[model samples]
Target: MNTTHLTLDEKRTLDYLESVKTRLSQLQESIHFFLRSINPETTPGTVAWTELHSKFNVLIAKYLHLTNILNDPRIAFNPRNYTVFPFEPPANDQQVQNLSVLLRTKLFPELEQADEERIKEGTIPGLPALPPSPAPNRAVNPAGVNTPVGTADEKKQWNAYKLKVMMHDELCRKADGIFEQQRDMVHTKVRYESDDGDEEDD
Candidate 1:
């Protein structure tokens, strides 16, 4: 919005930011789906499972592409310089790294668990098989190994968490839409005023 004033590099950075946001929304949807549907009994090779896995793989690739773009020295993309959203600080490098790790280490392993046969085969069309599970001693959570959602309490908690996350995402999207509309209106007003001044001069 009102990006006409931004330089070429800044505009490209903003575009990259938008791409990152869209990819992140997709990643969140995949995570939510896995949380809601994936269990110990989830059948592999099914349409839903296959499609989600493929989509997840695509999301991962797109995320990596975005990361590389941002990391390019020529781009020098700094999120802090462009404040698209009010009050929310741009994500720092640590936050981006944490997200990358969560997707790779946590989410990828969970996906592999859903289809052990495919994983064992070392490849699945769009997705690659993950390595063997880490040694128990080296696990991120040694005290609590990863397991499918089983207990009624666990299911309830997951559902609650998902609901909260979805609600927050919805609110943020709505706010962004409103902000965009306002920015567009302001831009249009400025353009009209400029036109009127030119007409007066003529």
Candidate 2:
């Protein structure tokens, strides 16, 4: 196994990524609480609902800020050494869904492909190539086998990729939940107003 050390810039980028992950985790917890605090009976015009909505908005702003930071060309492309460009978060829910789908189906797969190429080329310095999979005729490995594969450096690279994908998934899931709730609240408010108008006419 190769044992080359990371350069100072790479070390800083990794540290920044860790801090971003921590921030995202905290935001997820806060969003979960926000969702729980919201209820069907919570009217949109009420003080409680307003405060909760304000807090939710702040959380979303922070999330968007983080997204922008991650979308930066420097950090976004650093993982695969500029082979893949990250997607920008869209302004609407439908567009966001499209972006999420694109990431899952296209961008992420490209990153994985880039990793495979890197491993084969031994271009990532200390990371080594993964072993070839066993032939189909070979005995099938039992489920839940805990065998480790590849060198430590190779494992580290794969873990970093997993972490990146996980972070994106977590943020998108939480943000989508919050947006759905907001839409529900708007619909509720509109129905309440319509009912009040009919009662006044009657």
Candidate 3:
């Protein structure tokens, strides 16, 4: 894609998405640290739980808003085809996935509920259908395994290219090895046959 020709709106969208990703990472890190610091022996009271829950809800709302914005089909990264902008991988894959799960399970339904309320109130013009909400992850993984973050499809494409190259190299090496082995076998058989013929002649 010709990333150089990106429009102002596209650039702004990308920037906004990047900022959201950064904030999500920070929020996840904070939550993890807080959970780690707490002791199970001193069980969290209702008030403490409520406070944590509220904070989590706020984070999830923001995450869902940003994620939905990014998920707009118009903004997706495409190589040499759809998008004029290049895709970049986000720093925090685990955080993104966790945020995605939180959005899908809790935040998305809440948003839909809000949208229904808006429609009832006659605030928004039309009920623009959102992308189908995904199912939540049963358990989130810890930071940084191989889980893809922002522009995951782009990463997949790049990975596919790399895999193809690796496979080609492997096949070439294997073919060369096999050819050498066949050549050696043929040479050995020929030499043995020649010697046997010579012995017979003698």
The best candidate by lDDT is 2
Across 68-138, the per-residue lDDT of candidate 1 in tens digits comes to 75566675655432211111122454643432222223234554454555634634442233334445322
Whole-model Cα lDDT per candidate? Answer: 0.50, 0.55, 0.47
Candidate 3 residue-wise lDDT, 43-130, digit = tens: 3433376766776776677667656665666755421121111112233556345322222233345655665455335354322212
Residue by residue across 1-202, what tens digits does model 2's lDDT show?
A: 2225887776777687677767776777677567646754433433475787798887898788778767676653343332222322233556545534345443355665666566556566433443444542111121122343567764565455445555665656755786787689768977997898789799
RMSD after CA superposition, every candidate: 21.3, 12.9, 25.2
Regarding lDDT, does 2 or 3 come out ahead? 2
Off by over 4 Å in 3: 1-17, 33-47, 78-202
* Higher-ranked by TM-score: 2 or 3: 2
Q: What's the C-alpha lDDT at position 53 in model 2?
A: 76
Q: Please tell me which predicted candidate would have the highest TM-score against the true structure.
A: 2
Model 1 residue 25 CA deviation (Å) reads 1.8
